[model samples]
Target chain A: MGDLFTDTIVISVLAATIRIATPLILAALGELIAERAGILNLGVEGTMLMAAFAAFIGAYATGSTLMALLLAVLAGMAMSFIMVFMAATLKVEQVVTGLALNLLAAGMSLYLYKAFFAVEGQAMPTVAVMPVAPIPFLSEIPYIGPILFTQKVLTYVALLMVPVVWFFLYRTKYGLEIRCLGENPKAIDTKGMSVSLRQYGAVMAGGALCGLAGAFVTIGSSARFVPDITNGRGWLALVIVIAANWRPSGILIAALVFAFLDALQLQIQGIGVQMPYQIFLALPYVLAIVLMVLKSRRGRSEEPARLGVPYFRGER
Target chain B: MGLRLEPRLAPSARWQAVSVAVALLAALAVSALLLESAGTDVGVAFAAILDGAFGGLRTTAKTLAKATPMILTGLAITVAFRAKVWNIGAEGQLFAGAMASYWLYTLTGPALGMALLPLLFAAGFVGGGLYGGLAGWLRSAFRVNEVLTTVMLNYVILYLLSFLLVGPWRDQSSFYQQSERIDRAAWLPDLWAPGKLHLGFLVAILAAVAIHVVMNRSWFGYEVKAVGLNARAARFKGINVERTAVAVMVLSGGLAGLAGMIQVFGVNHRLESDISLGFGFTGIIIAVLAMLRPGWVVFVAILFGGFENGGIKMQVATGAPSAIVSAIEAITLLFFLTAAALTRFRIVWRST
Candidate 1:
């Protein structure tokens, strides 16, 4: 137990916490944008899976990390277009559409992976992972530097996205329109702005970000892609979006907290704790539920009123 | 010319059938493209799937056996969905039921003899019902979104199952993470010799029929449908909305639990973490495909069951991944949804 609290272990855990939160932070920020625009893209999980596979394939084939990331973003955007068509244009039930898209993504990813990548009796393919780039003077600091200043470029981008997304959602004119679209699409339509177009923009942006998150899971963290590699991170991002109450800053906090729990679980396992590791693994989910319940008990959630409702022109 | 969508007063049943057929053809066409991209001969692959699903009595039995749990879960989802309750935690409830039934069977099977079977089913149902009821209660009391809670609970339940399989329930004789097999007396007897098909299939069919009657004929079913259509309207009609929601959830959970129990006793004979293979999730697709109709759920479940069994054969025959079937299912669902939407709004070209 005493060994668990060592300085080295503490620093490593903190670093791991941030590292673990990177993909979630990226995904949640994207979800934040979409949800703010009154669109619930439950297809995030499927989108992530598809992007992850695309990125892995790109990286494996080209040996260029940039190419891989680009492919992932494109894959994510392409998948989001489907959601945009269904949720925004066709006016299908968002929940079921999202669920179906998830199944589609899962199946497509597995099929593509096996078809293109799998070679019998060979080890899983690996790539030259994205290199970690530490900030110049900040890296020289004792403990804080290693934990904060040193990370992959993608991690820094994810961190930077919090403030960027916050500004975009709260400060910009377009952001105001997006928020209003969620609360009342009729108002946006009355204003002579295209509700579906704005929604399409938000969903595409969100999808690209989720794709980046998926890419990070493979290229930013692990080298090789495994089947279902994103593995519920997309769902976790959805939970974080809700838990954060749709605030960009709140998303960062929630992601970090969830990541901290995950990191703690890893550390506990490292310390050779007698208890089963699955308990620690399940802690974050349990905590998320409790937090949601507690938050709900306070009052009605600040969920967008028109969220998940399809808008039709001239509909009473 | 501009495209205009005119709202239909009421979509005809004939139109609904035509739309579904169109959607199915589109899905198949898209699936063929996917198969081509995967480098498999689409015709050969589909033929293999057909052969695998219905080539002989053995394969047909395998498909039915696979369909048993799906039919049960489909009925469960149909019940909950009819009440407008999105009980996505059927997966978790299923694990809970299987665990409870397995625990009961291991404890009382030797002493209770044949009576243990009934007890196991009851235990499984009660276990799942309680788990699902928790979500319903939370939703009713706090207006919590059942979707999020149920999805979260799935992971929690999965971990709990993992803990049991790895810790207390671990069979010492095997290296695999699975519980000890129950006594022979506790096993669900097979209906046919030389085949794995068991009484569970019949039980599922009977349950589906019973649910159909209850859904279509019973007062409770009417109340549930009323609540689903409009809670405020149902409240004005003197129906207890919250109570119905909770009751629906319980029944849904119980049915899902039965699916788990059947899988354990009739197929696995031991509690393993991977026993379900996402049967609970697939049940959602089946229920939706059936358009929330109880009778249609049986047919849809069989269709999906064929896909599951056929997928493996397709994989073996063409070296194409069985995941294509899942992709196909999703495509079908997307098309079905679009078709449903089309039924409400007919396209018209207006000259500007």
Candidate 2:
């Protein structure tokens, strides 16, 4: 057991966990906002996918990492706007609309990439990644230095988002209005606030974050986008949102834990273990299932009270 | 004041039809604009799309061939959605069916006669049904959310298929990690001359009609719909909500499984990822576009089939990605969803 603790593989696994968790942390933070607004935006997967591709394209074209990141976030925000219109204004079933948007994003992005780039492979042009902004003296520190300082800009943003989100939700009036709209639109309506606008704003915010998270895969870490590059990270983000009981700070830790499991799976597969690599491949999903089961037993207390139910003006 | 809930009166069929048509037109217009913005000629693209969808006899055959699995999967989605089951595991279920049928076909090829067809179908059905049933069971027993469970199962099944293909069930002789070829006797007969159109097309139409009868005429179908519209009210009416949910799921899964069996027997004659072609999720689009009506499912399935057929041609002609069709389908779903939501309730403005 001590050997396992001291293993180089274990150390590398911890490093990889941070890398993997970056995207999840960012995406989950976004989802946390959307769900907190009583909007179930299932299209996070698709939005991330499109953003990932767009980020790669942008980075590859301009050879500038910042531009790629900005463009990706904009694209994500645009997609979320569509969801907001459907759910907030039109009052459709959030689940169906979200799923449709995801499918649309998946199909459109893949098609567009193939049409424009004319290539299909695991990697793309290697653009300059976001520079690791290490603190002046922190770089000299031991274990925490590499983990905390020597990472992409998105990593710090994702980490910072937890507190920022917590502050935005707990310390601000707008955040309170968003929560009120989610929990009870009627109450918000009675207060003379535009519930639809607040809900839309929250969902759009989530979309922007999801896009940035996806761009992290393209511009921050990998510097490339493969087909389906988002690869269920969006879903994992959804799981993280639930695991955190929709709390922003909790989302950060849950994202890290889920990312750790995913990173652990990769490390286990790499160690040349005798077990079938298939089992390792199955690990993340297995963990998701376990988490879901545990969540189901915890009762409906944790879920947003009015999740997935559309609010109509009058006739309730 | 006390709250009182009332049933929403059904909208006129003419209005529903109009809404669907308007949604389709909106989808096309938006996609056309997108194409134009992307520097493509919209007129040429539209013409090309049409030609690709139904250009010649060959195109029609291709469209029908593609429509086969879509029809079954659409039914799968429709049945499940009608009962409010939300079984998003059709893709995985289809994979399961193909694997099961392929496993049986490879094992019982020589010994099994024409009887192999029914057995293979059964294998596919059982595989899909069991997979779907697992989600339903979890939902009914533990009150687990079916949406998340089904979605998670999809990933599990995908990994399972990939693992099996790359490992134990791999055909060692082949360059690709694929299963051995199934027996020719189990292959579905072709009804078209000099084209890929097969018995599956006719089966799809027949199945659609059969579903229409079931949904409109059968007591079970009525129960499923009632349970779907309102579970609490359905239970109050003495309906077995859990049982109906499970039964609908099983039937839905069986339909999806049959889709897989058809692909293996009718088109691919083997177990592979191409058999799915994302028809499982595409079926969801079709069901939504059709508004979960069986008769309408056929029409929507055919429309999607045409788009898919044309999409391949578009890819060849314009170098557009094949996934463009998925994008269009997704847009249609989004449009329909918004349209349906707006039409469901009137949001009239009133001066305070």
True contacts kept of each: 0.82, 0.75
lDDT score, candidate 1, position A150: 89
Model 1 chain B: worst 10 consecutive residues (lDDT sum): B106-115
Q: Report the error of model 1 at residue A305, Å.
A: 1.1
Error of 2 at A278 (Å): 2.6
lDDT per residue (tens digit) for residues A52-155 in model 1: 88888899999999999999999999999999888987788888888888888887787777777776788877888888899999987999999998888999
Q: Judged by TM-score, which candidate is best? A: 1
* lDDT, residue A84, candidate 1: 83
Q: Can you tell me which runs of candidate 2 are displaced by over 4 Å?
A: A1-7, A119-126, B1-18, B37-41, B344-352
lDDT of 1 at B333: 87
Could you give candidate 2's per-residue lDDT for residues B1-352 as a string of tens digits? 3322222466556756777789889999988876766676777777777898788998888888889899999999999999888888898888878877777776777466666777888898888888888888877876767777778778888888878888877878887857767666678878985768988899888888888889889999999999989999999999999988888887888789889989988898777777888889999999988879988898888888998878777667765566767888888888787666555654444444
Q: Could you report the Cα RMSD, in angstroms, for every candidate shown?
A: 1.8, 3.6
Q: Every model's DockQ, to 2 decimals? A: 0.76, 0.66
Candidate 1 regions with alpha-carbon error over 4 angstroms: A1-5
In candidate 2 chain B, where is summed lDDT lowest over 10 consecutive residues? B1-10
| Docking quality (DockQ) of candidate 2 | 0.66
